[model samples]
Target chain A: MKKAIQYTTLLFTCAFALGACEKSELVDYNQPDMIYVFKDFDSDVKDSASYSFAIKDESLQYDTVFVPVRIMGTAKDFDREVKWAPVDSLTTAVAGTDYEILPAKVPAGAFSANIPVKVLRNTAMKTNEVRLMVEIRQSKDFAPGISDANGSSWYMPGASRRYLVKINDFLTKPNNWDSFLKFFFDTFSQVKYAFIIKVTGRSEFPSGSTGLPYAQFVYYETVCRNALAEYEAANGPLIDEFGNRVTF
Target chain B: MFTSIKYLCGITLAIAMAGCYKDEGNYDYNEINKIAITSDSTDVVVSQQDTLRINVNLSQTMPDASGLTYQWVLYPTGTAQTRRTLSETKNLSAFITEAPGSYVLDYFVTDKKTGVSFQKRFWINVVSAFGEGWMVLEEVNGATDIGLVTKGNKIYRNIYSATNKGAKLPAGANMIQIINYRSDQEIYIFSPNDMIQVNYIDFLKIKRFDEFFFTAPEPKPQGHYLLGGADKILYNNGQVFPVSLMTPPPFFYGLPLIGENPYYMEPYPIYSVLKGKFFYDRISQRFYRAGPYDIELSSCPAYNPALDAFDMNNIGKKMLYAEHNVTDQHIALFKNNNHDSLFIYVLDAGIDNAAIGKYDVTKVPGLLGADHYMMSKTLTYLYYSNGNKVYKLDILAQTSTLLYTFPAGAQVADMKLYLNYDDFEDPDNYRVMGIATNEGDQGKLYYFHIAGTGNFTGNTYREVFSGFGKLSSILFKSRS
Candidate 1:
């Protein structure tokens, strides 16, 4: 009777330990540390000349996470020059996996690129999340002659851009794959609005000596409240953030 | 919910089944050909070979055949004649010469399929033309106006008259009278005073200018929009635009027939060009395009009896006449009558009797007192009357010649030189056809012969008719 009781107790203890171990194995130690920032946030324009963005992923100090940033810019003219900063944004983007940007033929001046990164897991903490702030500026064209110490900053005429930062880890529980995936999908799915303004004026020829009468300055402003209105009308409804319904 | 699902599933299944079903609605008999024939006419007489052309229209009413072929057969007037098969039915003209007999043409058609046929028949005729005929001209009973002329088959009312303002004769009226020269087809003549009020609308239709639409010529180089064009009516803020094209509504200038709708007048006026210049009448004021004209608006003062030239001042008194003078800057009336005698001279040195009489140019008391003096003169002969008789004063001889005594029971309507006479030998040898209607119970015609025998020896008179109507002016149809 005494032996039977001791064996039963041992078996109960082993079962409970096994359950705890399984729970621990399921925990996700990887934390997202990717961030994307657009330099021209409020002044961002739609269908304007293209420009560049700066994407940073501080994942080396956090955990193993895919720090993929998508660079998006639009312009009215189909073929307006939009050279990217760090000019080789094209060759750097992953063709199929981490950042699968498409239209197999890369356009002449697309300012989209990716940086492959391997994050180092945090030693002291089991999980940690980091942010990467990227600055995006639009340009009608690029002037390699102009230089700035911080990533060689330059502008194209009539260029506009916006900054968008995405946080990877902002949750109470670490092993939330569903929530993490939802956030990842929601970043691109939200509807974005952009505004564009054009300024024009006429003056005397720079080379002439006589005083010349000049026409009044003209400014044209248009607000693209939601870029998705026309798109939604044409193509039923677009998938929105995390199963949220939106017509765009 | 489950029932709805089942219903949707059932409906989908039914649709699928229906797709498998063959469309048998179109699986009926085929109509290979539809043959129809029409004649220029239906019946005819013998001895005339009417060549009826058979038009064989080839069509395949059946959907099975890609194309069709036609087969024609001639029947009833059987194979006893030569050249019967009309050129092997290749959608070409088949010449079937019909002879002097009653005949029926039978036609047939066929398709590529073995079981398709259509047939039909038509009737024809051949006869001789009709010949010439005669007509009678009768006067309308009470009106005494010229009545009617019957020609061939249609009878046309005689509208001829002596006054120019009266009805104009038909275009072929003179030809009908002269060429036929048949006494049975006599035309009745009406006096000027016997004029009837002709309906203006019917008269316009007779004149062939009743209804017409004017197509404006292509607009000029520029600024033609001011004249006429398609315009968009628009309101400024709220008020409406007030521009309008104003003109009088059209009407006629004649009398109406019995049971005719009197209000069916022409609604638009046509523009007329006179003497190389345009003239437009609003049915009220006469507008001269490049000249002067007298005009009266709709809102004019009271009618004055003696008001001349559209003025309303001078009433119950003798009025002066003033025509627009081109060379002179003043009114130029040669004469005026103040209750009695009128004498007038004009720039045109010719005899227009109506202008002279209406303008009161001659010394004749018009239409009133008969104890009056009347005078008329040409270059050589002078005519003057002093209450008793008319005397022909020879201007060359400076002596008066007693022409003719005014016959009793006669009222002179008009006197003019005999336009029908070919020649004259002396100053007194002139011939005049006088229009006179007897003032007695029955009017009469007196043919007076004024001979130049110096002592009135050739003044023989013939009383033609005692109860004759008014003697209207005699117009020569042909001088030759």
Candidate 2:
């Protein structure tokens, strides 16, 4: 009788202990509202972006560049101003002359917004590139969020608080000149590229998904070839900057 | 300890016994009705715009036919298998609007009660009504229209205007060509400053001048040629634009063929089986060739003076006509810049050792003054027309034979040999020469049977077609 009572007590204890264990739930934290520059999830770079006016038309005097920013909290019913300014110490461009920071706001019920920076085409950009470093500032509605230096393993950060852009008007060989343009334009040379620009009346030759159809490149090839032939016939062989004969 | 272990074992046994206890739940089961579908024919052949009717005989194990829904669907057999619903009735009676090709027809019967569907499949071959014939391009009432001469010699005049809602093509339309590449059977009408692509089967206008290119060039269409159904070359204003039709539609012509040196190619393109495509550069007075898969044009390599009859790099004459003759030999007629001297240069179409022979035909009677020229694909003979007379010049013998003369008032407008690149075994292929004449607005066409020796069989026309308006060109529309 005594052993039966002891076993009954032990069985009850095991049942009670097993029933007390429960799955853990995550609790939301009450934190301050904050914002940061959103980074492309697939990109390895954390804080920089570059643009060249050489790929744009010569007639374009000013162009707007957008930087994406995301909030760390829930969206609100009312719009919120996103505070951002150029870091003077790291910036090589003059604010009023080289670029202008437009007003930016995250609209109501939206978690993200684009900070527009209108970059101007200055004559000095033709020979040298201009750099601008921007950072988020504390505002009335929100505070600066997680940054690369403050990020933890559980919450990795990107260019969350700061970003940089390099702008230039100097001509450089396009990224797709060999894979796509070479079939039509043969080889890339500064002289040939300049001649192509003059004959086609365009400066940009975009590649990748947004690239022009192959047929258009073929037209440029023919036009450039004919123009080069005429130019040579009137003058002599077209000599490039490297003292090489230019041919299509 | 022994007592506690015994009590725990008893509890565990009680729990295991509870898991073995079973409960009876209320449920039901039933068998589904089996359906069987049958048709008289599983293989069908129909033409475009024709009705396709098929009676389906379906039976169910349980007599609940009223609850069954029917659907018929048709889709092409090519890579783009876009299914189109044909009918919802038990019997299919739908008109096929698909292009000429193979297709699949499916009959689906679904039972509402069981939510089950039974299907029957069929294979369909769709043909075009205007599949094969001769298309005659003519200038009627100051505008261009097309006429069709069926294999049975049935004439359908003003077919283009009738099919296109009375919209007429521009005047001075000089060429009508059919490009039957892969699944594309397109007809193009070429005028001086305009060009239009029409449906090969219905002659309905499909595209206009600016639609043929991504960036439309000057509208000076010289000619359009196909290189063995692989590449299409379009010549406009002395520029050559080539596009590969080996892929699917939405094809646009790319830029002209560029070389290390500048060149202006004549309209004639000679495609050799082994040597890709050849073009005569009018500016440099030389020959340039693009390989089978090449986009750029390259000049022919230097040749030996003793072996080669003429230098391909420096012909120094204007190309009047260039086309492929018998076997691999291509015959080109050249005239001096002054238009006084005429010569015939015969060469193999291949790149190496291209020159075979050259002949001075400036002294041949009525040869230099000929307006139209066509080379025999089976023999070494050149057929040309001067005034109302058509002469057959024997290229081997260097002699000219007067074949036939039209009426005194008749003027030869155009001449073409009945050649079908798609159907070489066609009954009239290379055996009949069609000549169009204009005798004071009363246009007439004649078909002369060619003899084995490259002459007219009876020195006369075998068939004569009239009621045409000043024909400019005629081409055989072949069906694949």
Candidate 3:
């Protein structure tokens, strides 16, 4: 029993010594070298700056469209700088000719900033399509985030680091035109024109002569469209005072 | 002597050595002694789908970061504290699921090296999305629709139509009441010709209640409660045919309904079991006490011996407007007698002339009995309407004071107070009321807040919404 006791005590002493040595030699590594930017873009709705829409010639006055930018893991004390520029060869919309680009920088401790771009109007580009694509470049203060598509975060990052800007006079076709919007738009147009012609007794609608505001466009495209649909469903398809059926 | 001492010391040292093992070297004696859960509130009330953030403040911890295990266990509150792991992080939050009612969240931590553990429990109340709000019943073009107004002033219309298999609530529902019974919430919808009950938790499933629950049959009952109906009284001990008042005391569940043409004016008041389980039966211009006699003391006021019976002939035959609070055992009202008389009947007073008084509402002269009215949740005030004018009546003082009078032609259709009794984190502040009224051709809800006194005058209100139908009855569902 004495021999066994001595052996156990000796083993315990050696184990304790080894544990103390191991803990004393532990090292510290708690620094992060990179940060991330998160975006929450739900494919279901293009309501915000999801894709691209235009100010068009119908808007007599110039308008500015603001794009949102966000970054994660921002330092509390120092401000971070990010560089953005339009790819010259691929860009069709001129800077001073079409739209003006505003200052873009993220303040200290904030995860979000807005990039404002001024869009101009020209009657000649009413029917033709034009786009301005801006690409993001990394800087010393920040980089493209480690997690590009963060499902957990609010803002979803688009493919690569690209933003598309457009300016046009006519209604920019919605993305889901073929699947859902086509039928509603067609029906709404027919009823709308008929109602307009009957009310004003004119060949062309006055609002159409200029252009519809983006907000008015959405309202007429959805809310008013549904209301008119309900009316037509209760009654039959709309026709003019002279017994002429209306079509877009 | 030296030899004997040497042998004893050797045996002692060997025993001590034998007690120590290699396991002691691997185990860390240091561990967390105490732990506390800190948040905006310990007893928290959250709406469905809301996020709850919890931060754990630890008194001590193991030296190695990887040598500890954290767990957040959630379960319903009670003896059956079945464990459900919500998370394993040190300090973070969890998005509340759609489950409603009281819950217990326990933060458990175990030291991997020492096998020592610490745990603490947090009480979290998850209420339905319909928390702290008034459920308005609107009569649109003769059809019944229900609206919800939250304490935050958010309003929803025709919730019954939207929630229930697209089927509308009982059309032209005259009254809406939320009753708490047997560990569940039942919302009763009353129409003049029909009646139905639905579960407030689901807001979709209609309960197949006992046929007797339908108080308003073809003839219309003068009084209703858990035990009595149109002209009958039932016993709590058994489900048998009811008897008359002339029968034995045990059989007399309620007073007999009389009068050739009695109109059951008071809507059935939803109450907790501790308060007035019995209801008031008004027949032949007389009020009779009806319901179970047994109730807890804290809920009921000290019984006043003078309130056995009272003659309400001066007030009127039908109720112009009436609301009863079971917890306080009082029914505040505007008598259908149409004499501008407002009265408060304290059930504690058990005598023939037990009415507190007959107060005149002359201060608000032009006001009518009521177009739509409601009793404040505290049972302290009775809000009634004349046409466009609304007045607040102090039950104790028996005085009616003018609170608001809408535009000359605009008529107030309905009124309700939003009360939050289930929330423990927030102090009781009954500052908001929803009003449905018509100004011209349009009917809409002009929900407003009574800031300083909640007296209706100079209170801020927004014409927040308009609707397709006329407003009928608005009720704030209480979470008991």
Candidate 4:
């Protein structure tokens, strides 16, 4: 009975090992579920033309690398088209300029390799979350049917955060609401607000549960009206979807 | 065990390989620099003139050198001298003055590569002296039209022939220009043959307009001093005789050698004059002008001798008047009783209406602009008109009177008076005739006779010359 049990255990073990070692299309290495490091890059994209990353070296020198970046947020939701490419040769980059990316071999303790991916100007990334899928691979192995056997890695290319560019005391970025409120309050002076009140003549909407002060709400309404007036004075007024003047 | 080990090795190897990639980039380029000029040079020099040499140089800081050209110019000190280009190279040199005086020089330089230009100027004085005098002024004997000047100073017609041809007068000798009324020329001297034996005790002196030839104390070279008028004679006695009558006989005529187209009369009486150094008046303070210069002269009251004298209101501190001789078609000004001053009037029949005028006695000499003033249109003489009616005008009184009526179609377009001293028109003797331009303004000379009371006497007339172009200002020069 012991002999029969031993044989049976060996057979089962063999079956389990076979199942674990299944060669299904070379383990489908491409299906590693690409993790785009630049997924949130376009949230406050300052410049869509250039982006960079670091790499540990004494490694394979790649002629080119593929960085898959997707624009998320409203732009991606609508499937807006965007340009994607690897950074140009490093020799062409200016040293001190912030816009260019400088790549170097791992010097000492930390190994860093920057894989810069750029979006051409005409096809700039819109104001939205950009999901970048970047893979560092040897130029020779970059074929349609073959994947890099010994040279491929994923990385995020940017400051790894979002920021707003201040211009003329006004925030140039945060092309959305969340950061817009921060910029508005930070820049507005007391006298400027008072002047706004005198110019726009408007009160607040009735409060529901928020219990915000009526005067504060009134100020916001006036601010909106004044902003619209200033915009009209500069670039003309806005028209409704029906082609009629849009009154506040 | 072998299968598990192989699979583990494959997965681990893939992970290690994926993290191996390098970037080999080296960036370098050339630097950029630009060039520019910071300052321009002002140097120049003129020839022979003792003025210092002035040169023009450019002050610039440039990076690259390529197409650059320089130029210099010399202009006379006054605005009348148009600026001219002298050079196309950097040889900007000019003499400020041949001697001691002022001159203007301008320099310009241009960069061909960048198309940038620079310019500068300097006023320099050279060490040299001008000639002993500014210019020499002399009389052209026998030339009839000698533009006379005294030590380069333009002597106005203030003195006529007050003495003999070779005679010199005291520095401040008082004199008057004896204008011959007929030929429109001043009589520099009276011919000896034309002199007549008149009553020495009853010498005539011209004191006022109404009173001609008044009795005055005459002595000491009386012949050379008197403002004499000549008349041809007839042999009534054994010797030649002159008609004692105030009006000369047919042979005895008055010379009309003052001016052609009676000063301040004709197409229109337009007058203009310079009141100050730069002030110019073209119109008689009536028309509104939309131009660079808006000069208007206030027309004050006329000079009236009848009221015993002029009221203070009639006299302007800086004043001018347009006395129109409607019958003569000539315009003239009596500048502070200096009637023969260089303050002549010019009509504007061209662009800008610039009065072609020259100042009388200013240090800064140049021609100014002026116009004519039309007072009244009337025939001051009697008889000889298309309508056969003689017209007369009293300007100060502002009255137009008809002296005589004439037949139809004898249109008297122009009534011109002539001073016929020698009466070149008459063969036997001299006769001062009234030249009239009639019917379409055609000119004709007539033997005009008006009574002492401004009445018509000899209306019967004859026509002389024709086809004259409105007879512009005529300057008559006779055989002295």
Best by DockQ: 2
Q: Distance (Å) between predicted and true CA of B371, model 4?
A: 17
Stretches > 4 Å off in candidate 4: A1-248, B1-389, B395-399, B404-413, B420-433, B438-443, B459-478
Q: Is the docking of candidate 2 incorrect, acceptable, medium or high quality?
A: incorrect
User: Taking the tens digit of each residue's C-alpha lDDT, what string does model 2 give over B1-480?
Assistant: 675587676776677567668877656877788889998999998868889989878888885755988999898886754989999998999998998889988889999888899999999988776776778888877888988887678787888889899988876888887777765677889999988989887888999888898678889987887877677899998888887653334468756777767778989878776887888998889988887556688878787898899888889999999888977788999999999998999988864778889998888888887899899988999999998999999987888999999989788887888877667687778999988888777788888999998899999999898888888888777776
lDDT of 2: 0.82
Q: Per-residue lDDT of B1-480 in model 3, one digit per residue for the tens?
A: 444545655665576567575564666574353443455556777777778778767666335455668888778877744656778988647888837868888887777766777777788889877755777777666677777766676776777777786777665566676544434565767665445666685467464223533221242322234322212332221111123222122222222222123333244342333322333334444443322222111112333446423343333344444455434345534454666544454443333333444444444444344666676765567777878888776766656677776788888877776565455344434566777777776666766666555475355464466653666666667665
| Alpha-carbon DockQ of candidate 2 | 0.20
* Residue-level lDDT tens digits of model 4 in A63-110: 232222222121111212222222333222222221222231212222
Q: How accurate is candidate 4 locally (lDDT)?
A: 0.30
Which digits, one per residue and each the tens of the lDDT, describe model 1 over residues B1-480?
Answer: 445544555565575467679877886784444434343433423222223454544444344544445554443344545324443463425444543334544455545566455655544332211111111122232233222211123222333342234544332221112111211111222222111222211212121212210111121111001112111111111111111122121111111111111111111111112211111222222212111111111122343435323222111223222222112111212222355543221221111111111233343323232322122322333343333334553423445565555566455433323222222343322333332343444433334444443222355343333433333322212111
Give the number of colliding residue pairs in candidate 2: 0
Please report the candidate that would top lDDT against the real structure.
2
**What TM-score quantifies how close candidate 4 is to the native fold?**
0.17
Over B1-480, each residue of candidate 4 has an lDDT whose tens digit, in order, gives: 555655655665565556665555666765433333322333333323333333333445654567577666655576734565655666544433333335565556676767766656655333222111111111222211111212223222212222124332222221112344343222222121222221111112212211111111121110221111332112111111111222222222111111111221111123222211011122221211111111112222333455312321222112243333332232222243333332323222122322322223211111111121222223222122324355443323323355444334434333433332334563311122333333343322234454454444554443334433222112122222
Clashes of each: 18, 0, 18, 89
- The whole-model C-alpha lDDT of candidate 3 against the native structure comes to 0.53
Write model 3 residue lDDT over A38-79, tens digit each, in one string.
244433222223122331233365677665566655355666
